[model samples]
Target chain A: AQSVTQLDSHVSVSEGTPVLLRCNYSSSYSPSLFWYVQHPNKGLQLLLKYTSAATLVKGINGFEAEFKKSETSFHLTKPSAHMSDAAEYFCVVIHTGTTSKLTFGTGTRLQVTL
Target chain B: GAGVSQSPSNKVTEKGKDVELRCDPISGHTALYWYRQSLGQGLEFLIYFQGNSAPDKSGLPSDRFSAERTGGSVSTLTIQRTQQEDSAVYLCASSVRTSRDNEQFFGPGTRLTVL
Candidate 1:
């Protein structure tokens, strides 16, 4: 079975400060991972994905994540947080098995303050 | 090109009533998925359809839930004898194909409230 764990349920940062959201995973085979953001009452928008090509992946809105095989972690980071970045974020994993089913983490809510 | 679209952005039904949620994937996309998001919970996979192949319905919670993709395009999720605990946001997503790299595009989602 494959699953993801979001280390924090909520994160708060002041505008222009660095942001970090941690995630860990457990998968039997090679795994595909992703980060998605959702605004209030909106559908989820893809932020980035790591498909084994590179350990570091950049995403929209200046967000990025690094896949660490040793730690079983894929942590999202941003140089500076913006007010518009306040939202809910999810970390997902797709097992490399035939089904490739997507498993999602509970989620981390980001709150950016001015 | 249009993205995935779902109908009845919001629906409210009495307990024991049946409801159907619709989804239209991007043109030419061969994979459609259904998920449920409860308050403070992660998105739970409900079903998946790939082309004309038999759907993977292993994620469905109970017999009260079922889905069908018609003619390989539009899809509908039906919930029979709904209960209050069944209320949640039903989300639909589609991908170009079923693969590890294929990104799934999501729709606005339907908020279901069972009274």
Candidate 2:
């Protein structure tokens, strides 16, 4: 049983301020992590994925996340927020062995203000 | 290229009725998946099909839920005797199974409402 917990249900930031959406994971083994964004009435788009590669992963739309093994965290960060960045973000985990099913977090709703 | 697509963007049905939802995967994707999104459950995997392998029904919530993929491209999920708790947005996704990246492209979900 692998899962992710999004620390915040909602996060607000100014247009030019840095944004942070926290996520923590619970897994018995090393698990692949991912971040996805869903705009209003739109399908989810992958932001970034962390396999066994780099600890610091960069994603589209100026977003990045650091995978901290000891802390069991994969927090999404952005240097600056834009109005277009307002969306629902989900943190997902997959243990890719016998099954490829993903376990998703409750999601964090981002709100960017001018 | 067109991404994964789902039909009947919105559906409203009465309880105890049956409903079907369809999904069309990317042209060359070998793996397809079904997921449900709801306020109560967040997001949950419902089923999975990969190439010619037997479909995975481990994620399905109950016996009333079933799915099938035809010719490895299109899939349909049928829920019999739907309940109000079954009302949720059903999402479809496809991916190239051979690729280690394992990124899945999603379709605009079909929102199902049971009254």
**How much is the lDDT of residue A65 in candidate 2?**
98
For each of the candidates, the C-alpha root-mean-square deviation to the true structure, in angstroms, is 0.9, 1.1
| lDDT (tens digit, per residue) of candidate 2 on A54-112 | 99999999999999999999999999999999999999997566557778999999999
DockQ of 2: 0.65
Clashing pairs for model 1 are none
DockQ of predictions, in order shown: 0.75, 0.65
Chain A TM-score values, per prediction: 0.97, 0.98
The deviation in Å at residue A13 for candidate 1 is 0.3
CAPRI-style grade of the A/B interface in model 1: medium
TM-score of chain A of 2: 0.98
lDDT of 1 by residue, A1-114 (tens): 899999999999999999999999998877899999999999999999999998999999999999999999999999999999999999999857555668899999999998
TM-score, A chain, model 1: 0.97
